[model samples]
Target: MTDRDAGTAEASARPGPGTDPDPLLRIEGLRKSYGDEEVLRGVDMALDRQDVEVIIGPSGSGKSTLLRCVNRLTEFRGGDVFLDGESVLAMDENDLRRRVGMVFQDINLFAHLTARENVTLGLRRVLGMDREAADDRAMAHLKRVGLAPQSESYPAELSGGQKQRVGIARALAMDPDLLLFDEPTSALDPELVGEVLGVMSDLADGGMTMLVVTHEMGFARRAATTLTFLDEGRIVERGPPDRLFEAPERDRTAEFLRRLTDLSEDRDR
Candidate 1:
């Protein structure tokens, strides 16, 4: 096995805190594979309501895959995911998705639609709201993300950060039980990253239950109630961001954080 793989395997075997009897989101022994290569291996975690969990790991460490699997964007080979005690695997795909919204790494707004229209689409089609009501709901969410002025603009007319804010508004308009952010600011220019992270910080402060896959340590430190480190598809360490950042319990976690710090420093130079 690779060094990372060996370290993760050993770390994963360590006992963790006892599981809550009633977690808002529960993941048990989650596993996923692509052909012969496994991407997730016996993962387990639980989040209570209003928990903002930030997942950090190197590229190819299964951070994004785990988020996609939670929303059922990708099918898993084993284990179960639960939302509010309902089995996600057993729930209807449409129903499951309504409770779990995802904001992707890339801004996936509809090119032909205006920002307001993009936010209203799910409300109108999924929630079966009339145009007038959907428009009002869309406007409120857009305003929440500080995009009220860009409501009439199309995706191409908006900046990268603006498009991502619209994406966040669209997801929030759904009133989802939990939101998954998959490296939401990774595609933005460094200057634009702060705007999107600002919106996310507000959401966390507002008690939104979120699972975010990101390398943005600033946001994690500021907003994450819990920060998790995944490596070789296993959670090597997880705890409060203050604790994890100040003093990670494992060698692998410390090494990974150091690497990320070096990369961030290099980018700023």
Candidate 2:
């Protein structure tokens, strides 16, 4: 971590009279490896309430692995992750997932279920809500994503963007303290990317604490309060989006961002 990052983390951890001092999410000395390949190497990060932290990196840089470790979707080799001061590993797996909802690159909605049903599965099973109550809550979240009318449609009947939005509504229905998005729009058609990103932008604007691993520079520039550059299982730079883009403190960060911008421009052409 940079000196600026350390100072920022410290300031964010200090509490006001009515606030809690601990960060909303904290990862310390996190390490993960698959056989001979180490994905994460002693990573540390912290996020306060309502902070949208966007993580950008190359394909094999451990960005997605870090998010998985937080929710225990993938077990780590070392270190700890805390949510609201509670160790995630100590918490029950179901409870950890409830507190930290994840949306993946693939929309994993059940083909047989409607959009509303997909959103309500957790509410009904994990949350133990009755059908009527779950339906009501599910519909509300679907509406928030501008998909209320499609509530009755199956995943097969929806566009890629709509399917991903349903995935978002499903996560939001859990009322997670932090949302993890791993390339949520990567599966969408180019024209469809905006709809999903729009919902994410809205979520960021509405103070949803998010840790997103995405290459969407537009969303990163607009929605992220803090931008992180991870490479080869390490954080190379951490700071505000403007600083990283306009004046990166590290040469590696500047080169990576420039390459990413070039790729995005080529994609746009």
Candidate 1 lDDT over residue span 139-173, tens digit each: 99999999999999999999999999999999999
What RMSD, rounded to one decimal, does every model reach? 2.9, 3.3
* Model 2 poorest 10 in a row by lDDT: 11-20
lDDT of each: 0.89, 0.89
- Backbone clash pairs for candidate 2 read none
Please provide, for model 2 over 1-269, each residue's C-alpha lDDT reduced to its tens digit, 9 standing for 90 to 100. 45435433543453431134588998887999999999887677788899998999999999999999999999998989989999998899999999888999997988899999999899999999999999999999999999999999999999999999999999999999999999999989999999999999999999999999999999999999888888878777777788889998778889999998998899899
Span of ten consecutive residues with least summed lDDT in model 1: 10-19
Model 1 per-residue lDDT at 157: 98
The local lDDT score (0 to 100) that residue 16 gets in candidate 2 is 35
Clashes in candidate 1: how many? 0
Q: What residue runs in model 2 are displaced by over 4 Å at the alpha carbon? A: 1-20
